[model samples]
Target: MTIKPIIIIPDPLLRQVSKPVERVDSDLTHLIDDMLDTMYDAPGIGLAAVQVAVPRRLLVIDVSKEGEDKQPLVFINPEIIRSSEDRSVYEEGCLSIPDYYAEVERPATVTVKHLDRLGKEQLTEADGLLATCLQHEIDHLNGVLFIDHISRLKREMVIKKFSKAAKSKVTV
Candidate 1:
């Protein structure tokens, strides 16, 4: 597996809604492996395919703490089947957004249905950090970012910052 370059903020691709994966074939599995490599290299807890410039409904996450055994999960065409009424707040960050983080509120628990890496249908119930991570990544599938959940002023500030950074990168 190779570590793919993650697309940063202000990239229009990040706003594109990802298409569902038709099949979890070998190629798709390989993409998952690459995503895992990229996520680990980014040292992030979760990553979505759209963040890597692949407009597909795929994501990989490993919430394991440092020095602990890695527990990677692949979600293909994931759909949030259920969400708890209780709400929780988590300071969320994205691999695409880099150094910036903000508190976002979402359901404390959720049930997701998706295809596993091996092409098997799977349903997983998640709460706590896992639930937050799932919701964050799922937002990417819908062309939404955690920043979108924040106040418009703050969201515009973040977008402006990234936009400036992107401009500087191009000139350099």
Candidate 2:
């Protein structure tokens, strides 16, 4: 597996809704592997295919702490099937939006259905950081961002800041 380049903020691709995977074929399996590699290299708990400019309903997450046995999970065409009414706020960050984080309120628990890496169907209930991570990555599949959960003023400010930073880097 190879680490792929992650798409950053202000990329229109990030705003595009990802298409569902038609089949769990070899290419899709390779994509899942590459996504895992990219997420681990990014040192992030979760990643979505859109972050890699693939625009497919694919995601990988590993919430294990350092030195612990890693438990990587791949979600293909995953969807939130249920969520608790209780809300919780977590300071959320995205791999595409580097060095930026803000508190975002969402359901505290969620039940999701998806295809595992081995092409097997799976369902799981998640809470805490896992729930936050799942919602954040699922937003990517729907062309949404955690920043979108924040106030409009803050969201635009972040977009502009990233935009300026991107411009400066390109100019250099």
Task: Please give the RMSD of candidate 1 to the true structure.
Answer: 1.0
Per-model RMSD to reference: 1.0, 1.2
Query: Considering every candidate listed, which one attains the maximal TM-score?
Result: 1
Q: What is the per-residue lDDT of model 1 for residues 1-172, given as tens digits with 9 covering 90 to 100?
A: 8999999889989899999999878888889999999999988999999998899999999999889999999999999999999999999998899899999999999999999998789999999999999999999999999999999999999999999988888853
Clash pairs, candidate 2, are none
lDDT for 68 (candidate 2): 98
Clashing pairs in 1: none
Q: Flag regions of model 2 displaced more than 4 Å.
A: none
lDDT of 2 by residue, 90-127 (tens): 99999999999999999999999999988789998999
What's the lDDT for all of these models?
Answer: 0.94, 0.94
CA displacement after TM-score superposition, residue 3 of candidate 1 (Å): 0.8
